[model samples]
Target: MILAAIWACWTSAALGQAVPNHADPSAREILPNPVPVPAIRFLTSADFPPFNFRDETGALVGFNIDLARRICEEVDVPCTVQAWPWEQAADALADNQGDALIAGLALSPENGERFDFSSIYLALPGRFVTQADAARGFDPSALTGARISVRRGSAHEEFLQRYLAHATLAPMDDEIAALEAVKAGEADAYFGDAMRASFWLNDNLACCSFAGEAYFRPELFGKGLAIAVPAGHDTVRHAIDWALVRLKEGGSLDELYLRWFPVGFY
Candidate 1:
């Protein structure tokens, strides 16, 4: 049932690849050009690993923290990134506790109502993983009749139904179970978040390979990762957006991405 394929092979070595010279169009057109403030306070929850977490030395560190520091440097502003409780971060932002929140926050309308957001700096793209021997390139059309494993009730499942409706889906209770289905040869492939898939491939199962381009539909996967600022703080938002563009252009963004996600998915 599988037909032609689109090959876009990625490897751990690809993690160090240079960032593109240009910024994404979504970021370039995000704001109407605003000036940056001289100083800002950045808030984050340091409990999330790779993105934000406490180090062995008790220093709050990770991708978000490093990016925040780089953004501050790029904007020529004094900034402070402090760890706060995850649940309290939003309310703290609302209460003027900080100028920005850089913890892997998702973009949504409800969040848009209370805060401004920078253009997406990171994404958790969906991908397919197959056994190394059975690994092959894939496209939506190529997936017809293929047994794809997905977590029941997850956006990944919804995405497959909406886009690759021709494929047969094996809905499991959770991501691990779906992945296990592939590992056990019960399913042709597992469709899920690239982040989780990468971790599982590198640190857990060690029996699969990622296939195809990273899939990101904001409606299904969310608007990637962005920083949140208090409402009406266009300057702060714009500054972050500007810094992000510069970071992308200079490869700093990709550097941080490689640091956190050593395994490149896209």
Candidate 2:
């Protein structure tokens, strides 16, 4: 049943969160450093499970951890991670607090005003979490005027704003907080990435059933997520892109996708 619990995670197909004109996001693309650097500082959110999380001893590990280290290997840099809340990542990157972030963040326009983003990686759907009432039928519109929970800086928050206009929102630092918000009845529903919504449902609220199809708005939702760097750090930006291109060519991208998405989804 342990693995069954893990396997029960259900999610929607995908979303488009890519940035246009990524070849020169900031007019300066990075070139790889042939010589390896001794240390590089990286930023990530610890709350997103299977993608990134803290271990029992308080170490960060997950798919993004491995993916980021591989990127560092290709770019000839050593990385040290600083785990912070998801909401703080953009501000930290903008203020030069970290060299890069791998939090699977969307390339929102507001974030673009402050930082530079790389190319698209993976696009997944945003889903709704409802308790499966006979009358409501789990439609996003069914719960209008109800309180909903979302992560403070996610593209899904934008989704809620546009789709569930009648609903009031309660923003939290992480998806887990949003899950708790639903459990505690502070919010009527929880919204986030489909994979994340599945994880939240599994780890906490199994009684609730999810509903609806994937919705995507490329302009508002972003093209997809790529690693984000400070606006001025062109050297690092292009190097990461080059590494991703190689990863795509070398079949590493698909391999990583298979490794992380075993149940399989975009």
Most accurate candidate by lDDT: 1
Instruction: Report the lDDT tens digits of candidate 1 across residue range 160-193.
Output: 8888889999998989889888889999999998
lDDT, candidates in the order shown: 0.77, 0.67
Q: Estimate, for each residue in 1-266, the C-alpha lDDT of model 2 and write its tens digit.
A: 32131122333323322111222223223456655434457799999877889889988987788778777776677777888889988788778888889897777777787778766566555666766562155666677788888999788888778767898898999988887777777778877776666655655444564555545455545455678888877667767787776665555655666566543322
Error of 1 at 255 (Å): 0.9
lDDT of candidate 2 at residue 101, scale 0 to 100: 91
Q: How many clashes does the backbone of model 2 have?
A: 9
Give, for candidate 1, the lowest lDDT window spanning 10 residues: 1-10
lDDT of 1 at 8: 20
- lDDT for 192 in candidate 1 is 90
Give the poorly placed runs of model 2, Cα more than 4 Å off. Answer: 1-31, 35-39, 126-193, 197-216, 220-222
**In candidate 1, residue 28 scores what lDDT?**
57
